[model samples]
Target: MKEYIVTKHAIQRAVERLGQTEQHAPHHLKQLMQTAFYQGETPGPNGFIRKFYDHFKTKTRLVVIGEKIITVYKFPEAVPIPFADEVAQVIKRKFAKSERDFKRKERALSIEIAEFNVELAQHRLSYAKAKSPKVRESLSDKISELETKVGRIQFELDEAIKAFNAIKEGAAKYL
Candidate 1:
């Protein structure tokens, strides 16, 4: 038993060192695989894979930028736990990209709304400055257009806020 334990430790160190340049993150998850296998349960690749995700998730990053750019767990893989961990890393990267996309969309939405409001204000000023009835009427139509755009963006922002809240709540489970 002692020799087995020693061998496992040695293998873990060796593997970690071997992967150093490729991945700075330590393989703390390997410990769980070692303990479970040492007990003779003979966990197969799939079982060890589960432990790997759970371990890697808790020790490292599990929650990736899920579907909507919020942090969520990576997908499960069929390989060993280490494989799952690698997948989790990929998920994390995907999450980052998704998060950036979401932020970009949000910022664009905000800017659009701001621009609409500014247009509305400008139209109102134009309506006031109009010297002729036809020009005032035209300004009124433009103001109405701006108002409609503002309403549409407001609805979209509200929906996004709801989605963000749900994602935030769901993220609490992983943390």
Candidate 2:
């Protein structure tokens, strides 16, 4: 996220230019920058003139010194959202959330796989030691069922990884 400081002079000018009171100007300016759609920039000596459109659709130009806002001027025209970084934050946040969910699922699946392995081993031991054919057959059936479940879980884990990787890659491209 872009960081900036609001100066006293900037606050005064914003009040004057925006026709706002002293109490409202600083608060309003901060809100505008937070949700502002960045328009364009003009480079200058210490910083640049960063343009933006507030939530109210008011066109605003900020004179920035270093990371501080030095002054503000309001224009009559409306500015549209054009910054990729703005959309990038939303996309990145969505993917990050998805990634967390996928990772959680992957962990759960891994634990299930381990549990299945233990069950399969127990069934294998029972089958080997069983004197009766029926007992051996029952153990065999259970082992097969557990194997199928394990396979399904593995497939799902693979798909989740693929999705997480795809999102990561796609987000990186925009960044």
What TM-score would each prediction reach against the true structure? Answer: 0.45, 0.52
Leading candidate by TM-score: 2
Please give the lDDT score at residue 120 for candidate 1: 87
User: What overall lDDT goes with each candidate model?
Assistant: 0.52, 0.80
Residue-by-residue lDDT tens digits, candidate 2, 100-150:
898899999999999999999999999999999999899999999999999
Tell me the tens digit of each residue's lDDT in model 1 across 1-175. 2111223333344345333222322233233333332111234444432112233423321211111111112234556565666776666665566567667878999999998888888889879988999999888888888898899998997787677666556544433
True-structure Cα RMSD, model 2: 11.7
Candidate 1: misplaced stretches above 4 Å? Answer: 1-95
* Per-residue lDDT of 44 in model 1: 43
lDDT of 1: 0.52
